[model samples]
Target: MNLLKTLAAISSMTMLSRITGLLRDSLFARAFGASDYTDAFNIAFRLPNLLRRLFGEGAFSQAFVPILAEYKSQKGDAATRTLIDHVANTLVWATLATSVVGIIGAPIVLYVIASGLEGPAFDAGVVMTRLMFPYILCMSFVVLAGAVLNTWREFKIPAFTPVLWNLSSIFFSLFMVKYFDVPIYSMAVAVMVGGVLQVGIQIPALKRIGMLPRLSINPFAGLSDPGVRRILKKMGPAVFAVSAAQISLLINTNIASRLGAGSVSVLQYADRLMEFPTGMLGVALGTVLLPSLSKANADGDPAEYSALLDWGLRLTFLLALPAAVGLATLAEPLIATLFNYGAFNARAVTAATAPLMAYAAGLLGIILVKILAPAFYARQDIRTPVKIAVGVLIATQLMNLVFVPVLGVAGLALSIGLGACINASFLFTGLRRRAIYVPHAGWLAFFLKVVVAVALMGAVAWFSQAQLDWAALRAHPLLRAGALFLIIGASAAVYFAVLLALGFRPRHFMRRAK
Candidate 1:
């Protein structure tokens, strides 16, 4: 397979998902604004998403994909299908039980996550949490199907599935708000509906690949399967690693809840902006690299494994640095153009800009973690990341103590960005010390070229943004959006144009996966 082309395809699909997601947030901000109710909804939505990452995407995918790839590479088709059946059956039961418990304990969970929420906001959170809790079960199935498809090199379906969810939210948010006593309750319904759609779309793709799992009648039936046991064993450390990160998020949400009514919503808006480059680059690359890395390890080809990691890291730097520079330099314009409408006013835009810029400061590090952690994961070594994550968690809270008071909500974002840098640093050092990855030649020159290009790009972005007051252009929403797009387009063109002049080429990034 042409890995660069595959990466581009996946990134393109991911870009669509991010675009729809931004539209969804834009509609949400216009309709709801940063208020007590929006805070309630954001916190409520995060509850199921947190668990979904833990049980479905985060820990589960990291642990499951490597093993699945090994099975596919070594055990042949029938045996691989059997492994899929057992793993799928076990996961279905586990997530079902978790969802039930979460639904019943919604109030308790909300309290633990955001104790400061009270009265209407607290009530809304409990209701929404309960309504959306089953989303965990739906996404678990979706992610299992997605991981299977990704291992088979069928990246488009999984990359595109998120768009369905975003579309669903947009539809519901636009049409269904009036049906509920609490308008935001419609979003919870959207979450549930979107989850179902996400799961539904993956089924035919799985069947076509002949990897559709035949779930057992008895949920407990798969516990004795050796593959399932192995997955469970690996999941021990994987769960801890994912939980450490989620714990930090939970802590941040709790802090934001206490800080003020709209603090959580403001931070969430900033995070949405940050996730654009992350989902497009970090997620797209990690999804592609893990299976290839695992296959290399399964075949005992260390050179191939190292080359894949080098390719991913280099690609990350080439793309992510320019994106970071754009985000930092164009924060106000981007935030204002996308979300500065209705309830999300000038103050909200201003409030979100600082955090977005702070997040931009560590964009490279955040994306690097996505690339580096998978190197360890593909080798079935989750404990190292778990240890590093624990220390980063502690370090993040320490920084929060120093930053939050001084910078308010932006401080929380800064701490998380710095923590990601620390986490990425440790992962990179671990890879080097263990001699698992050696830097390919031309890295220093490559670094210099990207830095120079990013400098030029940043200057263009800053100059363009300064030419107008994005906030005052709210009356001219279309014009505001057009100008922002033009600035971003021009900045990106200059960055790539500089790289081309300096000696970078698409062919240099093209690698074939064995």
Candidate 2:
């Protein structure tokens, strides 16, 4: 597979999903606004999301894909076919059992996740948890289907399905809220619908390629599949890294639970916004690069894998650096413009902005992992990144405890950044130690160039903030959004120009059209 083409396809779909997600967030902010209801819903939503990432996509895909790819490479045709069948059958059975346990244990989960609490907020978490529990099963299946698609070099469908998920959330936010009198729970219900649709829609595409899943109960039939065993071996450590990240989120939410109603919601809001750029550029690049890198690795083509790694890293930074600057600088305006309406009030917006800035400070670090972690996965060396992630996890908890007393929720966000920076350093250092991919000597210079560009961008944004009457803008939607857009677009233009002058070219990472 061509790395550039694959990245473009994944990026295109992820961009669409991000766009729709922004709209979904905008509507959520405007409608229910952020509150106890929002926090409960976010906590509920995050539970499944965290699990989906840990067990389904992040861990599962990282471990499963290379094995699947190796199967197709070595087993030729028939064995590869049987192997896929066995795994799918085993996965579905396991997922269904997990989902049932989750649904039954909904109260226990809510208590543990957000416990040492009571009242309406606790009630909401319980109610919404039950509402969204089915998403575990739904999303697990979607991830399995996505794994199959990615292994087959059919990434478009999997990537595009996220757009459906976003749109589903939007529809529920707009329509379903009123009927239930509580919009957030209705939004929770959208998870089940979205996940089902996401996976179900891919079946036809898989069938078109004659690679659709088949049901079977014969797990022992393929227990010796070298690829399956290979994947399982890698999965042990990948789960540590993925789970550590998820556990940190659970900690954040648990901390926020004690802080009052809207803390989690605000963090969630800022994070959703932060994830836009990260998803489009960082995760998309990783998803696309992994398979290509795996194929190159399988063929013993280090040169090709190295090139793909370089291109992927460059694109990640090119996007993340500017976004981090923009987010940190424009946090208040963004919060006000997008969320300060409806039930979401002034105090809530203020609380949300701090974490947004904190998260912004570490955006590149967090996303750098998205790029660098793939190198280990592609090379079938999950253990090293796992060790790095463990060290980062310990540091994250300590920092969170230390800072939150002094800095509040923002400190939690800041600790996340610190942890991510440490995590990336660990992983990248390990990669370098292994002589995997030594970044170009100009990496520091490239970083400094971005900082300089961002400094210029920040000046304009900051000056405009002083000049613009935020109160007046918040009072009106159209003018508020227009001004925000103008500032963002202009700053971006300036940054891009500076990068070009610094010899940073998009085409350096992107493929030239044939």
Candidate 2: TM-score? 0.94
lDDT of 1 by residue, 343-368 (tens): 89999999999999989988888899
lDDT of 2 by residue, 387-491 (tens): 888887888899988989988889888988878888888887787777778566577887788788878887887777666765456678899889988988888
Segments in model 1 whose C-alpha atoms lie over 4 Å from true places:
none
Off by over 4 Å in 2: 181-183, 217-226, 440-445, 511-514
CA RMSD for every model?
A: 0.9, 2.2
Q: lDDT at 400 for candidate 1?
A: 92
Model number with the top lDDT:
1
